[model samples]
Target: MDVLQIVAIGLMATVLIGVLKSQRPELAVLLSVAVGVILFLLVLGKIGSIVDIITDLATRAGISMVYLGTIMKIIGIAYIAEFGAQICRDAGEGAVATKIEFAAKILIMVLAVPIVVAVLQSLLKLLG
Candidate 1:
């Protein structure tokens, strides 16, 4: 399975990172990022299928594509930000990781604003 492959790659990378950490810390960090990217790419295919399914459901529900798009963007930002933060943390840069997380939160909030407003409007309409 793909998850098994991902786990194996991750375990191998972890071992290599451990070995390289003492002699070549920089390379260890680079290896971490490379493995992360590789894993992300592997799962990227599944993401497309998931997006297609969600899109179909949204269409059937008569939901606006704009909101769906915004939600997808938010999820993307969250995942990307977390990925970046984890990389920073792996490199022993906790401060940088925190900043990355904060920035991601801000971006997610910005993306969610329109959805929140739309929901509020719908609620108001129902109440009225």
Candidate 2:
């Protein structure tokens, strides 16, 4: 199965991290981050395809590309934030991971303001 590949890579990395944790703690952290990135990259192609499909549908539905772009940025921020948080957690820094997540959520809220405004305008127009 396609998912098996991800599992295999994850298992291998887990083993390596365990082995290196005692001898080289720093390298273990690095290896964890590198493996995380590699896994993300492996599925990056699917992400591109999803973006294309969403773009096409948005175009057909008369949705503004500006909104789509904003949404995309929000999603990117979320994924990156999660990735960073996971790395921090793996390095035994739970506090740092929580901070990273908090920052990402704030950023997401900021980015969402435009879309929220646009939606409110549409609703107001409908009521009037």
Candidate 3:
């Protein structure tokens, strides 16, 4: 998970995609998708470790699992949305990318409502 290695690979892929785009646009799109998947796979192990750390910290802090789960879902949605949006953009579908981003934001807001409500309830209890 070296940043430099990932950057190098990305730069190489960009060059290859650029070279292929004129001659075989379909292949270029496939190559971009492949690179995105590969990059995501490379980071999955790191993501797992991060999740473990967060879970452990939450447990130690006596935080509600529901809150932790919601946070994780929100983070997952953000990453997935960004990934989809970037892929769409790479394929020259800016409108589709924007739509994906907009949908993701809406989903994130929906997921966050529970947490917000919980906080507001706690504040009301304290004030009362």
Q: In model 1, what lDDT does residue 22 have?
A: 97
In the range 39-93, model 1's lDDT, one tens digit per residue, is: 9899988888999999999999999999899989998899999999998998999
- Clash total of candidate 1: 0
Give the runs in model 2 whose Cα sits over 4 Å from its true position.
Answer: 1-4
Cα lDDT for residue 59, candidate 1: 100
* lDDT by residue (tens digit), candidate 2, 1-128: 75899999999999999999999999999999889888988898888889999999999999999999999999999999999998899889999999999999999999999999989999999999
Which of candidates 2 and 3 reaches a greater lDDT? Answer: 2
Q: Provide backbone clash counts, one per model.
A: 0, 0, 0
Error of 2 at 69 (Å): 1.2
Q: Model 2, poorest ten-residue lDDT window?
A: 40-49
lDDT of each: 0.94, 0.94, 0.93
Top model number, TM-score: 1
Which model, 1 or 2, shows the larger TM-score?
1
